[model samples]
Each structure stands twice: as structure tokens, then as C-alpha cells.
Target: MRSSVDKAAVKMSRRWKLICVPTVIVTVIICFTSTYLLLVKGTNRWGSGRGLRVNQNTRRTGVETTRNFSRIGNREEKTRENITKVVDREQNKILMTNSAAVAVCCTDLMNLDKDKAVIIGRRRKNKGFLTIGIPNTPRSFGKSDLKRTLKSLIQNTPNDLGQSHVSIVVFASALDQSTRLSTRDIVAGFPEHVQSGLLQLIEAPRSFYPNLSALTGSDLYNRVKQNVDNAFLLAYAMDSADFYLQLSDNVRAPSNYLQSIRDFIKQQGGAYWVTLEFYPVGFTGKLFHGGGRDMQQLIHLFTEYAREQSVESLFGHFKDLNVQLRDAVRRPPLFAS
Candidate 1:
């Protein structure tokens, strides 16, 4: 009777082990699987820098116009009121206070109506050595050919090369609701570029313009607004890279334009050249050196002398004063207006 009881006890213990081990294993697997799914779903819907309105812009005035290069940087201690986040993760997006800062970069979704020249996009920092600055205002709104232009530019520029050195900055600086919405629509189409930091949108900052309302239609007032706009564009890009290519909203480039421009700029090796022209259509296809001092000087010239001479003519003036002779044209033309 004792031997039979011992055998039964051993069988019962073995059965319990077999059932309990499988149940524990299944429970652990289910917990991990559920947690992973939820996390992934959350990220897809709300990730860091879902990308700012790649399509929107910042604006300014005088019957007026717009602003910056998202090719990107920053500063502190200048005593700013804290610009609303350029890359605000504030899912709450609770319209924050408006103040001025040297620069602001945004990587997440947020309201953009109140801020001007706020840097909002994936590529907040200046990447690579080239920044393409396109000034699109209310008249055109950067809608015409902007997509095509971006496609070609991006196609010509690869990821590593672009992420490292190339960024396209569209100045859609219209502060109005219409312009803002329009810009958002356009940029939303290129979420990929925004994420990659190859493209960005910017507007002018608060008080970016210095009381030009009184001088409307004066030569000092007329083109100064636009020239100043360009100056702002270049200013935003000054720290972005070694070279800046200024283009109009409606322009086209050849397949080899990027390579050709690279080669041309390289050939200048240590040469003193202020403006390299592609098509001679005002500032449509002009490339300027991205040196801070050089660009600031040129920007100064644009804002001050632009009141006297037109920007196109001013280009010639800058070249004449700055260099004995710089290459003004590239053969077969690399770009067209």
C-alpha cells in the first residue's frame, strides 16, 4: 500500500509541471506582443518632427511680401521673449507667447499662424555646403513649379550628399491665413524631404522689417522690401553652408546643373568672386559665397544701395567693386528663368 501511494504522488507532481510551464510561457509572449503593437502605432501617428508645413511661409509688408532658409542654427543670452517652438513637441500646441530669437528650429507638428520667420522643419541645421534659397511671395505663393523644382533638385542631389550639404529653402513669408494654408498644403506634399532635412520653410521674424510702411512706392521703399526679403533669405542661410544658390520660384535646371555648378565653384579655388550667374535674370540664378562677413556685406549692399539701383544692376555693382573679373556665365547654360 505504501509503494502504490508513492507512485501516485510522483505522477501528480509531473502533471502539474507540464501544464504550468506552458501557461507561463504563453502569458509572457502575449504581454510583449501587445506592448510592441501599441508603441509602433503611436509612433506612426505622432513621431518626433512629423515635419512642419513644408508648404507654408512667413510674411512681412508695404502692400507687402515675405522670408528664410531652413538650412539651419541658434543663439541665447540676447534676451528674447522665447519664440514659440520651431520644433514643438507640444502635442497640446497651445499657442505659446510670441517673442524674438536669433533663430528657432521646429521638428514636430504645431500651429504656425502667429510666428513670422520661425524656422519649422526636419532639417533645422544647415547640412552639407549648399543651400538653395527660393523667395516665394503672395503673388505666386511658391505653388507654380515648386514641386517640379524640388523634384529635380532632389533627384540631382542624393541623400548623403544632400543630407550632408544640400538644402532647399523656400521663403513663403506671407503671414496671412491664406498664404499660410497654401504653404502648408505645398510642403505637406513633400513630407519625405522635410524629414530628411533636405528641404525647409521659413518666414521673417517679428519686426524683421524696420518701419518701411511710410516709404511705400519710393525706390527706397519699392524694391527695398523685396531686396530686404532676399537679404533675409541669405541671412538665414549664411551659417548653413559654404555656398548659396539663389533662385526664383519659377525656374528650371538641367540634369547636370548641380555637378556643373559644383565644378565651376571648385575651379574658382580661392578666387574672389561675389556672384556666379547661371542665366543673368536678376537674382534668379545667382550663387553667392556663404561666408558670414561676405554675405552680410552683400546683404547690407542689397538693403542700402538697393534703394538706389535695382537688384540686377546692384549685382553688377557688387561684382565690379569686389572682383577684377569673375566667371559670369557657364556654357550651354545650367539654368533658365
Candidate 2:
């Protein structure tokens, strides 16, 4: 019986060893897998700063060593550089298009001038002349909007007003390359009017004015400054227009808009500075006798206001801007010089 019991005990001990061996192996495998997984996850989460590298130099010293390896920062720098290059390329394309548009417009201008003598003769018999100045900015570069605006003006022009007596002047700001090209294309569609000296396109060089994108002020202030500057330049260049009307490329006028303007001018007796209200709050810039003494006076007053505050406080309601202008005009000139 003692011999049998010893044999059974030995068999039980062997069974337990078999089960324990597999359990030990499984535990070791689990520990190793968890360690490897943790290292990999940590390296990925820490943005390349937590990775390890085996150093072969340690073999010379009879030791094993590891060091952290990182390339995330370098990768980010490369990404930024690539982005800048793309932006520069896009800007170059825009500039190229702008140049092409300017060239084409110039050619059109030359053709128009070839027949200037005939145009001048027709203009002499017209009752009144109108010069329309439109400024195109990068932000406001909508081809459809510009086309619609110009088409509306052409379609709505009073029957009594000769097309030769009207001039549409476009001033494209420096960064408005796309707008310039698009506008030139649209104007080209109307060959008869362009050849008649009724539509003129002008491009302002990128260096003509301060960087509008870098201006430090409210958006309204920047817009006001740009519009005023464009109007001032256009007026300064005007030589023989009886009225200078400034219109935005986005505004769509009524069918009678131009006719109403003519009537209004005739009613006002031709030599006046009138601010027409489009909306109840804001006024559309329709300076009668624009590019004349009245316009010069208005520009002078605007310059004074711009100088007084560095154009910083020129924000607020649109009415307020108009009020400031009226007040500036009412106030006596501080210096006649």
C-alpha cells in the first residue's frame, strides 16, 4: 500500500508541473507583449521624442547603450517651407495674369485713342459727360459681380445720353490681380463701347500704395481709405468730365439709375457736390462736378480728417463717416495754403 501511495503522489506531482509550466509561459509572454506595446504607443504619442536607438559605438566599450531619437521638429519645418513655396507660386501666377491683363487693356486703349478725334467731336455735342470710377480689390474680386454691374449700367443708360459721353474707369488695387484680369476680359466682351472711348481700364502697381493686407485698423477703415484713395487718384486724373460717379463692382442699379442721375444733375444746376443715398443709412458716392473744384475741396477735407486721426477712429456707423465729412466741409479751412 505504501508503494502504491508513493506512485500516485508522484503522478499527481507530474500533472501539476505540466499545468504550471504552461501558465508560467503564458505569463511571461503577456508581460513581454505589454512592455513592447507600451513602448511603441508612448513613442508615437510623444511625437518622436520618446523613441530609442541602439548605439553600435557601445560595442567598443563592451556595453550596450540606447538613446532617444527625434525628427518631428525637422518634419514640421519642412512642412512649413513647402506651404510657403506653394503660396509664393500662387501669388506669382496672379501677378502674371495681372501683367497680361494690363497689356491687353493697353492695346485696347491704343485702339480707342486712334479714333479720339471723332470721339471728341461727338462729345462736344453731348449735354453732359459722366465718368464712373470703380475700384477692384482682392477681397471684392467677383467676376460675375463686375460683369453684372457693368451690364446693368450699359443697359440702363438713358436713351438721351450718348454712350460717347460716358466713361467707365476701373482702378484695380495692387493685390487685385485676379480682379484685374477678370475685369479686362469682361470689358473686352463689349468691343463697340471700348473702341468708342467709353470704357477704360487701369491697373495700380503693387507699389502704388501701402500694403492693404498689412493695414492696422478695422475692415471698414481700410475699405474707406482704399476707396477714398482710388477715387482721389481717378479724380486727379480726370480732365474734362462734367460728373464723376463712383460705383462699386457689386452694386446693381435700377433701370432708371443713370437717367435719374442725369435728371438729378440737371436739377442741381451742374456745379454741386451731391451725396446720393442708396440705402437709408449709407450713401452712394455720386459726386457731381467730380474731378473739379468741388471734388478737390472734398478730397482736401477728407485728407484733413485722415491726418487728424491717422484714420484710426474712422470706424463706426456709415452715417458717422458721412457726418465727419460734412462737418469737415462745414468747418473753415484751418490753413488756406
Candidate 3:
């Protein structure tokens, strides 16, 4: 599942791309630059010292250990292959192809495939009103990462509002075989959620990513390549429901928060809107009211800025351009960290 992180590292460009891209990015970023540093600082401090937990140490130990294991496994596999090289070479073709698919599984963690995302899941037949996409990584800083986040969300949010009104997608974008299996085990604890079709664990193929080294910019926004991964979660959530709400891997909300959001959206009627902010600080508690087309527009907008700036920094610009009349009005913040 490792996607050449060493190769993904690139030196930040000294100068911005002036003539190639739109000037609006520079102009808006400059105008909104005042609060960005503070927003990030606040984002890092929320949720019982867990906050967003975007740090360089995320998954470091696990990845290094996996690499060591992979080296030993490869050497042993090579010796075994050499023994039967010519005898079973042709017969192993199908097995090798299947192995590659399983190795990548459904996760192109590096965003290697740019054109189309290959999403894999079970019981995808029933759609929902809202789909919460939690973009999760293994070996993160938080002691109570997905387990806490999923519990808060599932417990507070009702299982049935009417025929699968809501569902949770834990998009484990990056994980080694060990971590991946561990994640599945953690999620397996929620048997009712999975059996009821209220939750699903989905993954993408290796071909679904772009060249991260090309899209990357300053380290400020590219910590562990989370900016790209967050956007990946948003894009993946488009097909899951009528509305998409993004939440952090370690976040909590007040009880019945989903019902409140549903009522609020209903009260709005047919008003044109871009995004509904739930949390005051970052991208964790924002409810995006859109279907596939609406989400596609947002995915394009955010993915452009995701390379150089945090997603929270781009929210103001998105609303300004898409929903010019929308005010900064947000419902009482139910989500924390």
C-alpha cells in the first residue's frame, strides 16, 4: 500500500505560478491571509488535545516497520520464485494480477490515479440523505482516533431516519496490510452499523491518484499529504448521498446533530447555497448540500488550492464565488474538534 512517499517529496517553488493560473487565487489568498495562521493554530488545539492531529510523526513508525518487513518478505519471495521460475511462470500470471489488485486493494494513497477513482465497497445499493466521509489514516497521533469519532457520530446520529437516511464512509486512504487489517477489525466492532447498511468501509485503487510531487507546494499545507487526502474523502463522498458532510477522524458532535442539520436544510427550502459551516474553526464540521454535480464543482475548486493552502483557508473564497448572497451565518456549532 506504500506509494513512494520519498519520491513524492519535492522542494517548494520559490515563486508562485503567475501566468499559468488564475489571479483570483493570489488575490483572495492575500486578502484572506490575515486569519490563516490563526485558523491553523486553533485547528491544532481543539478536541481534547487531539484536534486535527496533522503531524509529521503520523504513521511514521508503522510505515518504517512495514518497509522492513516488506524487504524481508520480498527477499524470501524472490528465492521461492527463483526455485520455480520457469516451471510455474505462466501459471502464476493470474495470481500475480490478483495479487497486485489486493496489494493496492482499493487505496491509491498517493493519488496516483488522476482520471477516474476506482471505489470498492459492499451493499452499495441503498443511497442516503447524508453521507459522512471520514478520511482516516493509520498510526495517527490521536489515541482515540476513528473509534472515538465513529462512536460519537453513530451514537448521536440515528441509525434510521427513514430507509438509510444517513451512512458513514470511513475512507482509510493510506494503510499497510497490517494497519488496514487493524482498521477493519476496529470497524468490525460496529457490526450493527455495518449490517444495517448505515456504515461502510471503502477503498480506492492505486490508479485514482495524481502526481503528488507535482501538486505539492509549501509544507504548511502538505503535512503528510493530508490536504490531498481530505479532498479525496470529499470527492469519494459525492456518490453516497444527497448531501455530504465532512468530519474529522477524531471529532464529536452534540446528540441529535444530524436531525438538527436535516431540519435546518429543510427550512432553507430551495435557496442557493455552497456550504453550511458547523464548526467555527476548520473543515471538520462543514455540511455541503449538494449531489454529484454540486460536489464535482466543489471538488474541482478545493483540489486546486489544496496543494498550497489548507482547506479551511479556501472556504471563504468558495462561498464568495459560488454563493455570493450567503452570509457567514452558521447553525449553533454542535461539532467539537
Q: Specify the highest-lDDT model's number.
A: 1
Give the TM-score of each candidate: 0.60, 0.47, 0.57
lDDT (C-alpha, whole model) for all candidates: 0.61, 0.47, 0.57
Per-residue lDDT tens digits for candidate 3, residues 166-269, read 87888767745676666777777888778776777765554455555564444643543565576566666666677888887777867878777877777656
Per-model root-mean-square deviation over C-alphas: 23.6, 23.1, 25.7
Off by over 4 Å in 1: 1-116, 123-127, 140-144, 218-221
- lDDT per residue as tens, model 1, 19-117: 999999999987776555446433223344333234224222211111222232232221112311322222112112221111121211112232345
- lDDT leaderboard ranking: 1, 3, 2
Q: Per model, how many backbone clashes are there?
A: 19, 0, 9
Best by TM-score: 1
Tens digits of lDDT, candidate 2, 58-137: 22111112212232223223343453343344334322444654344333322333223221112223334777766655
The alpha-carbon lDDT assigned to residue 140 of candidate 1 equals: 34
Q: What is the lDDT of residue 67 in candidate 2?
A: 18
- Candidate 2 vs candidate 3, lDDT winner: 3
For model 1, state the Cα shift of residue 271 in Å. Answer: 3.9
